[model samples]
Target: MKYLSICYIGFISLIFISGGLFIMSINFLLIDFSLFIEWEVVSLNSMSIVMAFLFDWMSLMFMSIVLLISSLVIYYSMEYMSEDKKINRFIMLVLMFVLSMMLLIISPNLISILLGWDGLGLVSYCLVIYFQNIKSYNAGMLTALSNRIGDVALLLAIAWMLNYGSWNYIFYIEMQKMDMEMFIIGGLITLAAMTKSAQIPFSAWLPAAMAAPTPVSALVHSSTLVTAGVYLLIRFNILLADTYLGQFLLFISGLTMFMAGLGANFEFDLKKIIALSTLSQLGLMMSILSMGFYKLAFFHLLAHAFFKALLFMCAGAIIHNMNDNQDIRMMGGLCVHMPMTSSCLNVANLALCGMPFLAGFYSKDLILETVSMSYINMFSFFLFFFSTGLTVCYSLRLVYYTMTGDLNCSSLNVLNDEGWIMLKGMLGLLVMSVLGGCMLNWLIFLTPSMICLPIYLKLLTLFVCLMGGMVGYFVSYVNLFFFNKSLYNNKIVMFIGSMWFMPYLSTYGVIFYPLFLGGYIVKSMDQGWSEYFGSQQLYKSLIKYSQINQIVQNNNLKIYLLLFVLWIIILLSLMLLM
Candidate 1:
């Protein structure tokens, strides 16, 4: 609570405003940043903060992605959230969410970075339960609780680094000097990432997070929050390049990919399906990350961010127009009715399906190619092979359910793409989703491996896509012939999916079973925040505490002064003790 201050908040917003325009300005800003190339001078310049913050193309690009999605979420919330009575607070919280993310992206020291990292975990959980009075909290609760398990692991990893080897992140630039404890810590960090990113057993929270606001669903689940775990892995990738733990992470990642794709195939809700898609893609990225291909993983991150956000928004628009309806069974024949939104959804879907000219193809295909260089690439190759069809199948399901068939029976509100704000954001994102992937050089600082796959691989991927589409079409055709509950239950496919249960089978499992675990989380959260805020209100009312309210609400000078004193003592103590 004390952490929320105006200057801090404003500084974050400006960072977002600046970070949002990151990619657009990166190539152009090289000269502006070139003068600070010397690390000593950069450190001196950073003396203002103690840890010299030097700018790099990679960090800048990451900041922009964080800002761009966050700003758009805020901008879109104007329409999506404006009518809600709590809109102002929601907007403020949203900004805080992004600001924390910005802090994590740019920090030079591990301690500095972890401050932002933990902030993301807390803020994201708050946003997950933003709509305090719904079943959505169940999903939000699950995400919050599961992410915390990962958070605890991450803390241990960070603490281990700080206490042993005199290793500060400032020295990460010199990797060869790190000790055995560093390698051990690196493994723990991957465990943390696996939990954070919804990598396998953790995959369930993402689908459950569908309970949050649609915009949050887009911003957190798709573009940012979920990706932070993977982003952490990428940022620290080179530091742990040759460690065995890194290879162990690759195994977790590969299994997560298969699990996510399978689960999405059977999922029926529009948003959850896309949410599951995010898990699958993150798994693919992690797999690439484990193999030490940072560029491929990061490129997949960018490409997935655009298309995935587009997918989530498309889900939101459908849900919004239907008056909070999310079950696909409740929607149909919407294409002709909501032309603009359906159009945008279609464009994003095309990119997601890796339609050749769209943004997703360039990045996703390159990831597949790069992984194929090693033995494990076979896992990616086949997982994607099946995923190609699953992606097309589930994606087409959203379009099919919303627009293609006769409208289903769920009572719907009068469909309206009423607000220009939502429309403008969707249209703009559609453009970016289509074109953003082609801007590859800026995709990663590293050059990509050339595609050396035999011509048959392209043919194989196409065959996979066609078969998935045909299977879906055939299934749809069979549905008309005879409706049977058993057919909808594909046991063989489910069995293959059980292979992913390796993490789950351990006596102490990483994957929490039962989606309901997340729901209880929501009820607990509401109780806690309610207790905290209610007590604050009661204290103010009884004590003639206007000054207290002013301090809490105004958030200017006094709080920052307190923070300054607190940090002074902490840092001074650290210097003395160490």
Candidate 2:
């Protein structure tokens, strides 16, 4: 009861906070106002150390969204973690996670942002390893190390920003285009964003982080932690727009989008598939941001958060009922068993697929149309539409496996939607998932973006979606021969299925050579040559000298008699010589 009280308190407090922030954001938006509050911590020489917060429409709205999701996640976890012994600890970690995200969202200074950023990384690691298993340990390590790269990049950016005599980036973003140092800072910031958002080479950690509890997935991966990078880049978009760095980011993010979408199609783990989907959406947000549509990126980010969090919650309910089994192959006919969970899952999935009038459709459709209308290369165009199609492909495939097939679970397993607390959580996000797109569209964009394209181009998104759906459905039925074909094209399947070996590259590929080198050094130097010439040789020499001294000391009387004879001989020889 005490543990559950924590959830209630947090949920209620956060709900009130979220509502207040939302209203404040609206007022700020209507008044065209921003509040920047700065406190000087100290002044050194000519530089003033200050802590700053930027309360504009963007930050407030995002904070509201983050808190809303977090509140619901906490409410959901009351039931989800009810049986756990350490529920209080879990709740505390989650609250800390929320606080870290809030800090990251509101801070305008790089130093303050780093504090939040590092807090997020550290808290996420704790959350990932909450299960206290080998897999969780490995996942947590990978997540921590991967995010460390971004931390390093941010630190370097802060160091570079010292040239401007301030860590407050809001004041310097506009002038960034004019100076080489500013260009370097922008590049560093982009690199930091890439690692946080899990772009391409940095993407392995996002899916691996699914080893975390599903609630953590709902809060961290879906909305706050993963999106921190996107939010940071959104804030820095002014510096990146129309620059070579922006172009480079666009290319990298496009590839990330395509890769994540394609990888999700091949993935089987329920949580991992959703994680990959999050990665895909993040790529979408980032690519759009790099294209200079920061508002659209933020719009998509908010919209993605609602449905994705709902999706993860639905997944959590299903996983709990299924006795913790996560493989999609073992999940079938869930719609018949758990209607509410299934209904919410389907809604979230369709929204993810960009079905018309849903949350994802508004932002995703607009993004695709904007991409079509933009003067980008053919390759980027292919990537955008194709990745959109791939998203639909994976989503439909997931729905088919989990919701539409025969019951594939053990007969002893009894699955039902009995957890009302979890359902309550889902219900809140489900409403938002259904209507969040239209709501955010109006709130974020005062004037609609003018996107003009041909009839074919306009229909292209729909066409790819339909085609992808067909392929996804047909591919599921081919499971009978999947084994044989997979055996035949084993390498190809392995390559595509393993996120193009990104996990290997991030883990074994990164450590194997260094570990081998360290072993070689230990064997050849520490244990071999250095031991012989340094420690071992010195020990032998010392032992030999000690043994000689011991023998001479033990025979002191004989040594004195021998010395007397030698003295007499020397005296006789001296007398004869005289």
Candidate 3:
């Protein structure tokens, strides 16, 4: 009852705040009004420090969406974490997470942004390790360390921004394009964004972070934490677009998208698959932003948040009913047992695939059409469309594995969609997933973007989606001949299945050589040469000198008389010399 009251209070308050923010965002958009509030913190010679917040349409709308999702997630957690002893702690952590995101969204000062950004990292680490298991601890460590790279980069960027006599990056974005120091700042910012978004080399931590609880996954990984990078890039888009750095980012993000989509197709863990898909969509956003389409990226960001959160929540519900089993191979014919969850999952998946009139369709279709119109290289173009198809392939494959076929679990298990609280939470996002795309398109863009393409070019997206669906559906069936063939080519299967060995590379590939060198150094220096020539030698010499002193100081009459005579002779010699 105490936990229920906490949940209800948070849910109701956040919902009210979200509604108010939504209205304010719309008004801001309509009137082209933005409010910037600043407080002077300190002033030094030729430099001043100030904390600032920018309440623009973008930030307001994003905050509204974040709060709305958080409210639903809190409501959902009432039932999800009801049996746990620390449900209140979980709710508080979630609220802290949301507060950090809000700070990041509003802050314009680099210092304040860092505060918010670091808050996000710290809170996410706490959430990831909430399960208090080895897997969760490892995942939390990986997540923290990976994001620390970005935090370091952001710190460097902040230091570099000191050269401009201000940390308000918004004022210097245009000036940055012409200055070398500012350009370096841009590079650092991009690096930070990539680490946060899990682009390419930084991508390994994202799927590994699935050790977090489902509600955490829905709120942090799916919506807020991962999107921080893209949001940073969006804020700094002017510095990157049309530059060498932008082109480099374009390639990297393209590869990231392709890698994530391919990896998702081979993944069996339900949460990890969703995490990879989130990575893929982030890549798409980063790619478009690199091409100077910040609005489109923002559009897709919002749309993706709705559906992805829904997808994660549905997965959580399914996992809950399945006795905490996340392996999709162990799940089948779920549509019969958990029809509401299956229906919501399918809706979210299709929206992810950009089915027409769905939330994803609006932004994804625009992005593909715009990419088709752009004059990018063949490599990137191919990556763009191919990755799109792979998205469908994975979505269909997931649907087939979970929603169709014979029941794969033990018959003794009782499964049903009886969690009404979970269902209500899912239902809210389900509506958004179905309608968010079109609504966002209308709200975000005052004038619609124009795309001029031939019939075949325009139809390419639909064609690839169809083909990918067919492949995904057919590939779900296990044939003995193909299975044997796959077994024969185990190395290839392993490579593709394991995200091209990125997780291993991120873990062992990074630390193996350094650790090995440290071990060698310990053997040769600390234990060997340093011990023998330094500490051991010093100890022996001290012992020898001590023994000599002890012998000289022995209380023997003859030795004492001889030493006194020698001292008298030396004194006489010294007196003669004087």
Candidate 4:
């Protein structure tokens, strides 16, 4: 069974090698190979929907990261999901997801990308519902439905591209400059990306998706599934730059970043907190991409994949030790009992908070510096800085609750660092989380992002990071002078913690009105007038008419004889008149 994890790692190594080969030949790597199977043509427009594979730096780099994170996740799952009887099935599903992601990465044609896109949606649904519990079922439905919106949006994009006589969006991206139809298509693509990435209204699904196994969370949320949307937008960035749709996405993504950061501060569930952080990072990637820094966004996406996956694996280790408890309140003194796990958690957390020289610093610092150099409005600027601080705020609080305090659990609670398999899985990511950013920064950009600004503007991120860390540590970790109170009890805290009631909005708010209207329509049309006027009334009226005619024809011999005499008299009178 342990060999299985090794086998997967070996496969990932092969992929890494292949990607390295392409990386070496970067000069000749501008290759697009379309394999046409010559399937029966369905349209008169001569649309040859072929299987296309695009090999370039972007696709290859992204593929390497995906496989790297996936291998670690699979190895982690060997121990994380060890108790499950269907571990084989779980591993296979994960492989399917990775394969689908690869398909998505290599496909330049919109029509063929559907295969990968649809594969992602379906396999994710399967993984989400793998637990087969009520919570998993609900979360799976939300995940599926949210992604279905993107699927439909993609379909609309395909329909719009029909007028261009080709489904290869890459080829048309340049010609679409200043085209109104292209703008609309770009807007639809943005909408699709938004939903898939869980921006704003579609965000509830990300946290809810924690109902899945932690390994699934690590892979899907970190490297593969959620990033798919940002990747899509990155691929289509040329068409979207300076477009109205890009501006709209920029605003929304900024808001999402702010909202998620605030929400994370208010959260108590450990996994959900990390999940929210992932959401915040996603928003960051999306916002940067919207700002026309596709390379920066891609770099961050790769770096985030490393540490974020490591972060989830650490969370899983803690949860496994804590008897499946996800609440931070129930955890304490873990640093003493499980030094290895605690160290990894701290490292990942620091990297996430953009600590200097770590993986995140390379990409995150660049993003902030780039933002500071841009000409964004005050609101967007404030959101970026405030969200950066909020990140550290929640992170520090998490550290306090989990790693720093006295033992908060009962005497019977058992905690240990005995999960060697899981530890082995995490160790790989721990190294990557430490060095992945630097390596990616060097390889991808080949140079630093040049920015010259006022000292105050330059140090803005550092200031926020320090301030957030101080506040977080002071309020949560320090219990000597001040009494610690639960922010969850406050009305404002509840609002922000509940993600501005976005869960309710995306779930009940979205479904309630439509459901109410549907019920009304059913009552009024299906059960009321349509039934009465269509089938019920018509049948009743025919029955009544039949009854009346039957009564008239039955016991009326004198009436019949009088009618017969009148008819004969009328016939004779007509003949005489003629």
Candidate 5:
């Protein structure tokens, strides 16, 4: 007989993935057993590999989340997916993705571990474009390409580590001897993380990934992809705690949080908006990575996973029922029909807004508290405040644009509350979104003994959330000066809304970065010519001459390769000099 049948494949995959989680969970709880090791020789040194099948408290906690989300995604897919003839293939890929995530959760060795990471990346791209549409395919392609840059950088970092420290789990714990090599490697790792987590300049690909199915969006945005970057930070926390690059991560993450929050508002596509919000949330998580509390960061990941998945799934249902329309303007007043979905959507929104007693409130509040105390001295403290404000704006807009607006519902309601299968999967998460903080025992994402100074700061975050929701609700509830336009279309509006600076501020920030850079070079050349040869005309002739010279420089892969090699050599020489 074949290895499996169409019907039982998903079941089998789920079982194996669950088995991995279960094993890891037990290990976490029972810290007595040593990690299981698998040995292999890489560069002639025989390395002992540990399969962290045994669960410790930490691994068990995270694996539980991993299992739950993975299972829910699987269950939801049962109903979410149309019963295409090739259902088996889809199930297989889903299982594959689950297997990859499970492996990633407990990966003890970098070599085998990266395979799991890449597996998630591959499946995410494939699943995003699963429907094989023009837009989805393109989105998948670009997203995969962007993620690969991070993936490759991570691999490079691993190579650097292998040369310096032994590739054991304890290597990061003893990084007091880090030298220039480690710093360079650390820089590359941060680069990998920034790209993978969609920090700032690398933020565009995540929004494009909205073309994927809703489950994919939920998985990618919530924990698996973006969290991997945070996870990397946590895993290597000790090594990165006191370094220039570490400080730089803190700065970049804060800026990223602020920018992503801003970007989320600028988007109109439902998924893209959430995608940007995910980036913002991940930025927050990354910012907190170097703090003393790893558990806080981890709990935030859990809470984020719950609500973000719920919201994305809800958005998917809205999109699916509304005949593939993703624009919010086209989808007002879905609450009339999708009552359960709308309710769940509201819960998720409230949770994301960090309304009191919800899951997000605890985590966001803690971060705010931490910021006030530890992060105030990090410079431009107002950026974090603005980030919080923008989180309100974007998350509110997310809720307002989809569920509460006018019933522009031209498309027939084809879906009914995501049905029982999906609902069964989401109900637990929805309930948790509602009362996640109260049920602390079950949701063991955070440590019980965290030394947080929980005072009025928590209340302030709750207040912020409340106000944000009310603002959004009011905007969506009453049609007050309705301007049905996207920020991209509203160029002047984008300039103004992006905080009052237009001409000089955005000179090269977005689409024209390359052109602005080239123009700056030409201007510099003119300045140098004037300084040396006492003439601007000389620069003009030189520009014309370069234009003529371009004919000889055009079209040769060999020359390009040679230039690349020479540039790399020069770069290495500079590093040596440093």
Candidate 6:
């Protein structure tokens, strides 16, 4: 515990000081000591790769937040996993994850970035399967394979970067001045980012990854792994803007945001609801980024990280008290027993809904304002508003089921928030979730954008919040018996509730047919026709030849002469015909 705390604290202090100094200068700090560790390879025109790090406002700010959250998560885990035999190992994995994320944040070179990127994928797979259950194993495989797609994309991007004679693509972000090679690189990199961020087609892994421990979820979902894509896109925004790829991303990201929001509303698992919420937020970040609002995306990324991490900590406390029951249907009246945990949950939920003066307000509100003022088409506009409302809808439903509902657990259940160490961890992020946005806005956006919208446009967020709250209350709490109807088993309910069957689409839907075909091919080709005609036939012929040779050796000279004469006669007949 002491060792882990010291490591986390030191990182926190370093990031804080570094971010402070960078902000004071308002200029990027490039730490290129690659000459000390540079190397040349003969394969690709003497290509040189350097271990360079960049310390800009974006990188420092993000690094500080990652370290801060990681510190709290490690502190939290000291209690959450205290009863387990592998607590030290858990802490070690957490530390390694933090190290990888830091490497990703600081590195400016594409090659260096892959080190961190692959490290994140590897460590996350290990952490996901830490419990060593079938569920954990399956989830780990899905997560790792899903992320491997991104790793491959990055590798291809590096190969393409060879066109520029350098691996540090950061220096050439304005490659629009060069050639169409930028287009291919930009597209591949964006696709890589999408996979990492769980955008659109690659969205299933995030929810499945909830099979991991809650602390890992808080760290990975909130700040580190998922946000890596957004950060990468932010770095490359100059090259992506005004391109066809940017417009495509804008459309897909908005759809993803909308899909996740709708999915969360129908979700029942307590942790999954939070996971889907994280997905929605990622989509939000991507959409704003696709619209060329990198700073806005960055702002929301930090704010969302704080509150979401806190929210997960609160959920973890509840789950721990409930003895690992994650189903909301099995949990109710938690506030009656766990007041502190409940309060933290409520605060985080409100912040997620963009409650005024809270962490999300400064960033989320600004994003809505900017989107409203922008000249987006009707489809994107509707997606933004509808998705915003869904956020409120799911949040309210979650609060209703877990906090205010009647007692639903077994009579013998004993649940309470009593772990001091866990509470301490929650407090750090809780404070940040409450105040981090305001502080970040002050530091990062020294001069806030001034907007002058009409009354309805300004009130759009409020209207959605109110409507969503009413809908959530009605759907979750209304006495359906009074209406003489039961929609619990409805197919439409099941469809939306199951994330539009995206889990199947991403998992079994992707592999089942291919695996079935592969099994068929293996049976027929490897063991059937090929074996019969090639190996089996060859074996039979070899045995027959050996038998003939043995017979010839054992037979008299007359038999050998007769066989040779017959062979020669047949050969002469074939030659005469030819």
lDDT, each prediction:
0.69, 0.92, 0.92, 0.85, 0.69, 0.84
Q: Provide TM-scores for the models.
A: 0.77, 0.90, 0.90, 0.88, 0.76, 0.86
TM-score-wise, the better of 1 and 3 is 3
**Poorest 10 consecutive residues by lDDT, candidate 4:** 28-37
Model 4 C-alpha lDDT versus the unseen true structure: 0.85
lDDT of 6 at 30: 31
Error of 5 at 108 (Å): 2.8
By the lDDT metric, which is better: model 3 or model 6? 3
lDDT of 3: 0.92
Tell me the tens digit of each residue's lDDT in model 5 across 465-515.
Answer: 566556655655553443454433577657533533322322245335756
**lDDT for position 450 in model 6:** 91
Cα lDDT of model 1 by residue, 156-256, tens digit: 87777765544355455355435676666776777778877877667666666777788888888655677878877776786545557666777777777
Tens-digit per-residue lDDT, 541-575, candidate 6:
99999998988889698897998999999999999
Report the lDDT of model 6 for residue 566: 99
> Which pairs clash in the backbone of model 5?
24-55, 27-54, 27-55, 27-56, 28-55, 28-56, 28-57, 38-49
Q: Compare candidates 3 and 4 on TM-score and give the better one.
A: 3
| Per-residue C-alpha lDDT of model 3 across residues 183-269, encoded as one tens digit per residue | 899999999999999998998899988888899999976568999999999999998778999999999999999999998987899
By TM-score, rank the candidates, best first: 3, 2, 4, 6, 1, 5
For candidate 6, which ten residues in a row score worst on lDDT? 29-38
lDDT, residue 356, model 3: 97
Candidate 5 vs candidate 6: which has greater lDDT?
6
Q: Residue 22 lDDT in model 6?
A: 47
Candidate 5 structure, TM-score to reference: 0.76
